[model samples]
Target: MSPYLLIQLAALGLYLFLVAVNWSALPEPMAVHFDASGDPNGFMSQAWGAVGIPLMVWAMFFGLTVLGRDPGFFARMKRFSPSGWRAWAEFNTLMGLGLLTVSSMTVLYNVEAIPGEWIGYSVWIFLAFAFLAIYRLASVGR
Candidate 1:
């Protein structure tokens, strides 16, 4: 499997593991959102908080991975040449991996497995790395 696929799988697996381990410990109505200062500012039922975001991440990853296998689809949408279409597909998959990482970390934070402050800082750092990855992948074969 591709490194991107492996990373996505590992992230999703880790998220599921974390959620399972913390399931019983988490409050009934969990904090799903945080303010700039890292305080919980928004909330949702524990079921949604634990499972909903991960499901969405999984769906997005699956969709992007499938799309990556069909360059013609992206080409038709964006007028990319074959190689450009391939690059776009890879970049989309990379973005999905990044989202999985961020979402997993956020879930961990919400479950109190990690420090609240780490969420914001880690997200910014992840964004920087994600941009770099996208730039490198998109520039391939150019």
Candidate 2:
């Protein structure tokens, strides 16, 4: 198995574990959205936060893994696909980790395990990673 896939598997396992153990501790209406200052501005049921978000994350992992395996899938998009598998792996790893980070942070913040400032920071950090992924994709083949 690819190292990226293994890392993704580990991340997914950890995420599931976190949600399962914290299931009861999480508030009924968890804070699922935050404002510019990291204050909770929107809420959703714990069920949605715990289940719906993970579903989306897993969907991303599934899509990335499938596409990575068939490098040709990306090759079809000649304009952006990088020439090497490393670029693809990095893209997948960064994206999967980014999703897990935000979702896990949401859980931790709602349980008062982490401060609100970290919430805003995490989003910015991941946004940087998203841009880095694009840069790697664009630069690798050149």
Candidate 3:
């Protein structure tokens, strides 16, 4: 298995574990969205709050895994050539992991599992690292 896949799987597992451990403690309607100040600005039922974002994250992971395995898929998309598909997949996986980390932290914050001004800072850091990773991947096989 690819190391990227392993990391993504680990992140998914950790996210599921966190949700399982904190599910019951989450309020009926949990804060699913936050404003610039890190204050809750939107809400959703506990079911959605706990599962929705993770589901989306999992979908991205699955899709990217499929795309990575089949570089030919990129040939149909004018934006990318088959030669660059693997690197694109690598970049996607990196971003996906970053997103998973941010989502997990957001969930934890909403459930009050961990506290502080984390969401904002974490996002900035993730974006910076993601861009750097993508740049490095773009230079691969050149």
Candidate 4:
């Protein structure tokens, strides 16, 4: 596996580990949504709140990996630039990690393990990663 793929797997593993380790301690109704100021404004079933986000994150990256394997998936991009699948992997890894960070923070926040305000910080971090991913994607095939 490329280092980028490994990093993506690591992110998936970390997200799962966090959810599993904290599952029992989480409230039945978790505070899953927060406002601009980081206060919880919405709630959900603990199972879904804890598991849904991470699963979605992993699934999205996994889909990207699968798409990369399709015969014609990278052909067009490869024609324009040789980086090909590696570039996709890099983008996938970053977006996955950024999402994982935010998801993990929300899970932790629900347990009162983290301050309410840190969710915003995690969101900011995700946005930074997102912008970097955009630049990387746009630069591909250049």
Candidate 5:
């Protein structure tokens, strides 16, 4: 399996685990309220987790597995093409940036809806910076 895919699977599993943990902590009334409202707060919290933790893990693995390795390391290790990786990078970068912008605006507009709006803002800003750093690195190479 591709490292990226593995990272995603691990992320999803972790996300589910987090939800399970958090869900268990809530009272029945709040849980029902969350379900009724589609749990926007929970959704945002999970999203932040899914994006933040797993991406860091994947970056570490990518650095170790791909960087300073053999020239055809990716080609031999995975079936994904360079073009496909490029597309994936672009898509994720845009999504990361979008999430950052949206989360910031959400914090600014509805600070009472969710806890830790300041943390969310900071996390989103980090994600935005990470994406921009990756984009800049990619562009310099190209």
Candidate 6:
């Protein structure tokens, strides 16, 4: 496997490990059962977890496949010379920053629901996508 694939797998493993370690501490339900549903942040946190976890997995696996097929991915990224790059950067920034913030805040607010185990998985997934977004955004080499 390529070094990049190794890194991706390792990250995935590490995240799973953390989630297992903290499983017992996390909240039982992982959601607002009653009136708490009105809490926007709380709702957002749950939404992030539901959406972010899958997104992270998709991005890492997809990105790995993409980069693997084109080992010169970095070169290609750096070669971008178009106004579209700005739009790409903005899109990624919005996605990465938005998801990262929501995920982080969810972990913070729902400490019970987000024990070390869940937190690890949720966060690592968020980070994976966030990393991809950041990389893509930052790759515009003028």
lDDT of 4 by residue, 43-136 (tens): 9898778887667766788678667756677675545344656666777877778877888998899777999789988898789888887787
Each candidate's TM vs. the true structure?
0.75, 0.88, 0.81, 0.87, 0.38, 0.39
How large is the C-alpha RMSD of every model relative to the true structure?
3.0, 2.1, 2.8, 1.9, 10.2, 8.7
In order, how many clashes per candidate? 0, 0, 0, 0, 0, 4
The better-scoring model by lDDT among 3 and 5 is: 3
Q: Model 3: which ten-residue window has the lowest total lDDT?
A: 74-83
Estimate the TM-score for candidate 5: 0.38
Judge candidate 4 at residue 11 and give its lDDT. 78
> What's the lDDT for all of these models?
0.70, 0.83, 0.74, 0.79, 0.44, 0.46
Q: How far off is residue 18 in model 4, in Å?
A: 1.7
> Could you say which candidate leads in lDDT?
2
Residue 55 of candidate 6: its Cα lDDT?
Answer: 51
> Alpha carbon lDDT of residue 97, candidate 2?
87
Q: What's the candidate order when arranged by decreasing TM-score?
A: 2, 4, 3, 1, 6, 5
lDDT of 1 by residue, 59-83 (tens): 6766676666665656554545656
Q: Which window of 10 residues has the lowest lDDT sum in candidate 2?
A: 77-86
Task: Return the lDDT, model 6, position 132.
Answer: 69
The full ranking of all candidates by lDDT, starting with the best, is 2, 4, 3, 1, 6, 5
Name the runs in model 4 displaced over 4 angstroms: 75-80
Please give the TM-score that candidate 3 achieves against the real structure: 0.81
lDDT of 2 by residue, 64-92 (tens): 77577685676766654435566777787
Give per-residue CA lDDT, model 3, range 17-133, as digits (tens): 888888888888887777777787888887777788667866786577666676476566555654466566677777777777777777789778766368777778889988887
Tell me the spans in candidate 5 whose CA falls farther than 4 Å from its real position: 27-87, 90-115, 133-141
Off by over 4 Å in 6: 29-40, 43-142
